[model samples]
Target: MADEVGTYEATVTVTDDEGRTDTDTLYVHVEARDLPEALLSGPGTAIAGESRIYTLFGNAGDALLSSALWTLNGEYQESEDLGGQSSVSLKEKITFEKPGEYRLNGTLADEAGFQAQDSMNITVWSPTAHLLVTLTDTNSPVNESEVLEVDATVENLGQAKSDQPVWLTREGNVVDVIPGMELRPGETADVTLEWQTDPGDAGTHDIGVHSLNDTDSGEAVVTPGGGGDVFFAVGYTSPPPSTVAPGETVQPTVEVTNTGTATGTQTVVMLDIHGTPVESTEMTLSPGESRKVTTFSWTPTVSDLGTGDLVVQSEDDEASAEVTVQGSTHFDVEFASVVPTNTSKITPPGPHDWINVTVNVTNTGDTPGKQDIRLTRTVWPPKPTLPREQKDEVQNVTLDPGESTEVELLWWSPRTSDLQSCDGETKCYLIYTQLGIHSEDDEEYKMPYDRGGGGGGGNPPCTGPNPPPDSWCGTPVTLFSASEIEAGDSVGVSVKIYNHYASTEWRGVNIKSHHVSSYGPGSYKNWQAKLEADDSAQPGQKIKVCVTMESWAGSHLRSNYDPKAKAPAARKGSFGCSTIPVVDGGDDGGGGGGR
Candidate 1:
């Protein structure tokens, strides 16, 4: 039997039992199946001209997979089994000889008559080059006359080889190269170079290293020499001797010379007296040079009585010299006394009227020397009355070594009623005699004596014998008052003028008073008064002068006592007055008068 569209059937009978027949029908319907999807691919990037490892992956969507394979730039590179799965992966190691873009693909297959394919983009690039250099010195800061050594290192970090030359130089002088060889990729080399330095001025110098490729260079610094040792001698010349008196001044000179090769500057110059330095100065000296120096002066006093030594020294070099000084001795003369022996009167009157005073003169020292001895007598009022003028008489004599002489000095005091009755009560006349001895050395020795009443009382008559006719004569005059006064006060001074000689002769006379201590702070003018008289007046005459005090207070008085005496007479009588208290805005009173 057959169905619609296309059918076919067949029937059969069995032979033995009942003969029955059966039939069957057959039908057919026809359609096609879908194919498997293609495999997916990706693009690739790489470092150019280098070996790189890469992996490839495949995907076959809804297909029964059997095996997977990879291809680079249209060549079979690798293959992997899928094991009845739908995806596969493959790995490959590739080396690009040139740098550019390339293509890679993957393929997959299955047993069901299905197949798939995938592809990707690839790129390649070139590598970069690196070079490094370093320089080193084991011993640095090289001296001027020393040898200098330096070491250098060079390295290359690229894939290619290098043949660079490394050079060394000092102060622009070219030196040796580093092994004169080539260096491959990833290679390093060390080079050592040496050079000697000549002696030069002390300073710093530069050392340099250079490579031929201009990519490696280095520099270093060095230096060079300095200080050492130095010698001296000094001497001095002795000074000449100098003569100096006890109270005189003398300056001495000394010379110093530098005798060494080196110049020396002022340490010190010492001037000494008796082994002790009294003064010092400084000086500078050059080689073989001499200097004359006036160090200092020496003045001898009474304490420096004997010989002494003056030494000069150079304190820097300890050089010294000595000089000598000498001293002398002195002698002084004095007259002790001059007294008469008897009170008898003479027939022929002597030049002097009064009795004698025997004089005794002595040389105080033992040295024997000639001297002109003079005896002088000064009478007050400076003029004469009656028989003779009150003049100063001088007589010359000689003395032996350590010897004394006794001579007579005579004077006359006329007998009068007023003088004789008041002899003890009245102020008598005084005579000042000074004995002086002169020598060729111009040295003078003076001895002054006083004969008068004590204070204001009169002196007694002479009771000794009359002197010889040729004896020296002396006159006596009295000083009654010489005293100080206050401001605006009157100053009256009285002195008795008398004659002591037997003959009547007139003599010119003058009076002077030196106000040695009566001055104030400023300059002072001299105060003077004068008087005149003849010898025919009376046996004694009175002379008086007045002084007026100024209006300021001073340290000194208007009158002074004898400077040589321990105690002197006081100013008294009407010529003297008590100190007046200085009053404000009042007129000063005048000083009292004296008889």
Candidate 2:
């Protein structure tokens, strides 16, 4: 039955040596009953010089005296008042000077003068796993290149595993971890780690080994000898392009500085990821000097394309940066070197018949790639004839790496009415220059600065393309004429040759072509040529002139071209009798310029 939990005063009566009814009374402080309990705990085995903790747990049966008595091997050691507590724990720290077995006990007392006791036996012995470090070599003086070896032996003699690894320490700083020190009960392992001698390692160093449970130490003496005195620190690298083709030569720039006291000479090597040297450059630098090396360049073969590294190495130090080598298809393009070459792009207006724009594209990669160049025209401040038109023309060019070529595209020119509308407004053709796939740059083919009310800077208003040379103009009735005049055939007439080009900036291309598309290229296909060839007196009006075409009468073509005619062969004229196919002076157009 469970005892009631409360404090109570009780009387105990006893009579001794009294024949009559005489009683001696004593008062008892009664506390609730509890089972006498005790627990004594300590390590069953411990190393002799190591302090270990022993704990005692006990329950005062009735909470009376609440005192505990401790003993070792039945010898009275000490008494601890349990503070009259029913249940309490007491702890003591014990250290054994000698290894042996010892018995420990905890006795508890209750209010009824009853005693209950708990006893435990602990076995104290030397540690199971004893670790020792030995510096076998008496390397009295070690050279910088000399390697010193330290051996550590660890044996786990207990029934449990030991996890503390044996480590070598220099001035208390752990310098190396002896591999495979984890001992499996009764298993022993030995490990060794090295300390390489250096020029700065000339003085004495305290080297020892250690573990958690038990430790034994030893030392090594190293006297300095000749070794590395120079150290190099790598700073930065200007790596070659990540991608390249076979036989592509690439340059890698590496910066290295000598941080040692001595003048250091070392080689910076460019190597494949596999550590194979691809190229090397050697430099000699004073202490604290940095040198950027670019003398070494590598030519990669098809077989050499892969990831690589650029390494700066000296006798005692090394540093590296990662680089890559592979074949690549890189796409890039620019508009006149991009952004009007840095400003908004603007070009002179093209021929009246059609707008022709040329772009120069270069493949700058090391591998062939495709470039799709598109020219688009979108008229702003839209006009009726222009009709907010968007015409897209794309030309695909496959260029070998390092190859460059010129490409040309054409668009329908703005009609006379469309140009008239742009006279007073910010209305101009917004020509978008598209290179590659998504990149776009733009240039403007703006309206003429002088948009005279008379049309085309005062030249006759051209509703449609003027008659192309070599065709109808040769005889007047026909619109387009024969490609060339027959031999011994000569003819001349008076008519209007309207060359109402807006500005002089429009060169290298015919500007006055209208109503039709004419591609005479280098041919003197404009009216200016006709007036130049004539020997007769010139007309006073800038646009009107007389042209006598005695087309090298005997030779059919202008076999005997008159240099005195002063026609520019490069920009203005072509194979023709005298000047360009002569234009017949007109009566209605007067001396004013005609188109």
Winning candidate number (TM-score): 2
Candidate 1's C-alpha runs over 4 A off are: 1-241, 247-250, 264-273, 282-284, 289-292, 315-336, 343-595
How high is the CA lDDT of each candidate model?
Answer: 0.42, 0.49
Q: Give the range of the ten consecutive residues with the poorest summed lDDT in model 2.
A: 550-559
Question: 123-153 in candidate 1: lDDT tens per residue?
Answer: 7543533334567553556764355678777
Q: Model 2 over residues 65-139: C-alpha lDDT tens digits?
A: 468888878888788866567777788777755445788887888766678787887776554544333344434
Q: Would you estimate the TM-scores of all the predictions?
A: 0.26, 0.27
User: What lDDT score goes with residue 577 in model 2?
Assistant: 27
Tell me how far the alpha carbon of residue 30 in candidate 2 is from the true structure, in angstroms, after superposition. Answer: 99
The TM-score, computed over Cα atoms with residue i paired to residue i, of candidate 1 is: 0.26
